[model samples]
Target: MYRDLTIGEKGKDVAQLQKGLRSLGWPTGADPSGTFGSGTAAAVRRMYAAMGYAAPLTASAVTPSANAASDAAGVGEGGEQPGSDIEMGRSSATPQPTEPESTVMLPVSEAVFVPSLPARVVSVPVQVGDTVKGPVITLARGDMTLTGFLDPSEQRLIRTGMKAEILAEATGVHTTATVDSVGAVVTPGSGADKTASDSSAVTPQNGSAYVPVKIKSSGRWDKKYADQDVRITITAAATSGAVTAVPEAAVSAGADARTTVTVVLTLNA
Candidate 1:
């Protein structure tokens, strides 16, 4: 599935999606966030039309879509999801993740540099074909950021405080992540727009203009990705710390029976 595919921190998935549609003349008008959303779906539908396909599920905005809210889901169980042209033709010989060909209008790749071993020298081992995971910025230190443009025919979810997933290429092992931040603005991808920050090497940056949330990691979160294909899922959720763990199958039983899982708390004091 390789959902995580951004190169560095702040990878622009939405913009890339929108830009693809724009290239096809649909125009999503959304700057990429490297995060998939409503606008991205619309873009995919537009692409499908250009490819001569009938109104696809995504484009059928009238009826509620099952995977409507989801973005960049990985290949399913060693096979592509049915009805998705992009995955159906995936080459088994060189099996790997690929965006749905029928959905994506155009593809865009940004050039990036990977840090060399010993954390001293830096090199650009992977490029276009490679993928990335969450916050490529934190790992691709010293690397620059690339922002994408938008087209006119796009939509957005625009729910502030709602969670989102990120898929980025990593430099090391594992390429997946959870939501670490949320949007404060409600953008409909009809040309969505949106920030601030500082620290006294530790304190906080007193802003001069409108301020943006500035959160400093406690250094506990993952940060190994540098230049690899990664997948992120912001949709799935659990309580902080996942205090109560349960198998996926158990979830339904737990929900239907109103089973209350205990949240054990231990104080070291």
Candidate 2:
């Protein structure tokens, strides 16, 4: 009997196993190759089902029968040849051929992961019939929040609850948002934090430090704007009524540590 070929095994033997499965009308999900991955394993399961195996097969390895090559040559169980379904008036005394030991391919159970909450697919790096080596897809959960980084001077002027205007230059979509929070700690400008949306007008060229800020849209945001760079204008301070103005020369500080503005009154008699 040939040695068992299991998952994660590579090389010519795996390739041969893939070919054998294809001959049995099973799709391996990839071109016949040396790697025995999930796709190959799934194909093996399909082969088992076609062979009338009961549910919950125990073995995960493929054990080639001593006459594996002959079986792959179109000779099936009970000495039945491929495409010769006509049982021409055979004699009743004819003895039936015993099933071959090597033709049986066993399947092992594999675990599947499922997410609890619904999510949006951000990206897929691999396609059908392609060999999967690493990450296959990216997912985004819940509503998207915007994050941005600010330089030291800019951080000092920003505060939570301030109104901000978000502009996407490419689409010219304008949306109103509010400052949800301001990060307490400072981080290097080069390492822009990703926990929030990045809305910087221009990235720092000299690698200066920056503070993280979180912003939330006033309403549901458009899905098309996700991951796109945007410009943000924040209203740090504002005034509603009239205010007094003074020249720099008329203002002074007294010894009492109080600010005084000199008023010059001219009377014409």
Candidate 3:
């Protein structure tokens, strides 16, 4: 028997499995990339339905008719005899309102199924023209996150309000972001260590811990830059300020602890 297919698996085995499903008229969602993912799992379920197997049941799968029948069954077992006036009245009573169709209906993609336990797979081992059963691929889904590390000094200079300038070295495109947090505990090292920094300035040869920094950006960022090494600049520092100077001898401290500067004006006749 061929080994079971699962998510995170790749190579000729996955491609072979995908090709087999396609021959059976199942859609794998995309061209066989040799990587089993959610799209592949969906195609497997389609195959199950094709072989007269129903998709696993879920709370959302209960149909309106099934619910009505269940309710009727409960009433029938309440000691009501057939054709009795009480039973007749109950039957003729106003029907209970059901949830709006829009609220109860689920999209085909969102439907969750629970197939029989111990899972079933194709009885016949995967072959040139044989079909298989059970999940061909497992799936894991979650939101993406961006994590980075900063030097202790750099971390102290950063705060939540600081705007981050992200530069893509390949495309020279820029994206704007804001600091979300600065980690409390220092980590021994981070992804940035393995990567070459934009600047060749001196760096600590001995491994130095870094504070984790999380960044939040508005709108969408090009997925092409994901995991690709990029440069981040903290642009929230004071770039400009007005300056005035007074001689120290002309300044005095008041009782209130505030500094006082006396400017003498001489009037000439």
TM-score of each candidate? 0.18, 0.41, 0.34
* Candidate 3 per-residue lDDT over residues 1-269, each given as its tens digit: 14445545577667766766676687678645787666666776787677787534223222356556566656656666776755755574435555433111112342233222222222333456556465443432322345556777766677886788888798787888888777654433554544433222123445577666777777555666654566778864563677666888999998999998989879998
Q: Judged by lDDT against the true structure, how good is candidate 1?
A: 0.36
Write candidate 2's Cα lDDT for 1-269 as tens digits. 14445556677766766776676688678644977776777887786677786423233434445454444443334566644442332322234355432322333222212233334666789899999898777766666767666776777899999999999898888888999898854544434443333433333355556666778888767876776788888887779989877999999999999999999889999
* Predicted candidate 1 versus true structure: per-residue lDDT over 163-248, tens digit per residue: 43334544434422322333233233222232111111111123212212222223333444333234433333356664745655
- The number of the candidate with the highest lDDT is 2
User: Global lDDT for candidate 2?
Assistant: 0.64
Report the number of clashing residue pairs per model.
Answer: 43, 4, 2
Model 1, residue 9: what's the lDDT?
A: 18
**Descending-TM-score candidate ranking:** 2, 3, 1
Q: Assess the local accuracy of residue 11 in candidate 2 as a C-alpha lDDT between 0 and 100.
A: 76
Which candidate do you rate higher for TM-score, 1 or 3? 3
Residue-pair clash count for candidate 2: 4
Evaluate all candidate structures by whole-model CA lDDT and list the values in order: 0.36, 0.64, 0.58
**On lDDT, who's better, 1 or 3?**
3
